[model samples]
Target: DAMVIQNPRYQVTQFGKPVTLSCSQTLNHNVMYWYQQKSSQAPKLLFHYYDKDFNNEADTPDNFQSRRPNTSFCFLDIRSPGLGDAAMYLCATSRTRDSIYEQYFGPGTRLTVT
Candidate 1:
């Protein structure tokens, strides 16, 4: 089926080390989004890519970054992994930026920091 897919569903990283999570889609959606979700908390929108344009949430930390080289691929880069940074990172896609459109989410990548 055409849908979003996240790689390395489980990730382990050392403190201060950099880790990257990847997302891809066969859906050919024009909008791609990245989110961080910690235990017992709501998913936080870190950033998104509307085609070639990048839009980041104002409150997003400098440690979080994203890259979308093309429509089919996107990546989340953690500059330095911290113990508190361990959480589920989600990737989502939408056909349009319109509020009425439904967003499709990937399974997510769980990061563990040691």
Candidate 2:
């Protein structure tokens, strides 16, 4: 049995190094999203992929990018991580926009910069 999973629930990154966080789901959903949630703040949408459509937030920085090669997987590529980039990265999924349009999130990948 396979399911949506993110390796290393916690990630320690440097101030200006590149890091890649990954996500995979088994629900066979078509829409996958990545969000950055800071302390007591809203989880801001960084980007997402509806099938093959890659949507990025208007204010998202160039340092943040994503890739979804297939339906079951998506990856968040954080290039040149900054101190501000340290936060909880959440991965969510949904089949179609239904009443339960709610997305299922992972344990979150916490990034720490030294």
Which 10-residue window of candidate 1 scores lowest in summed lDDT? 94-103
**Model 1 lDDT per residue over 1-114, tens place:** 999999989999999999999999999899999999999899999999999899999999899988898899999999998898999999999986456488899999999999
In model 2, the Cα lDDT at residue 112 comes to 92
For residue 38, model 2's alpha carbon misses the true position, in angstroms, by 0.5
User: How many pairs collide in each candidate, listed in order?
Assistant: 0, 0
lDDT of 1 at 95: 84
Reference-based lDDT, residue 108, model 1: 97
Each model's C-alpha lDDT? Answer: 0.94, 0.88
- Per-residue lDDT tens digits for candidate 2, residues 1-114, read 645787669999888888999898988888999999999999999988888999988999999989899998899998899899999999998767465576877778998987
Q: How many backbone clashes does candidate 1 have?
A: 0
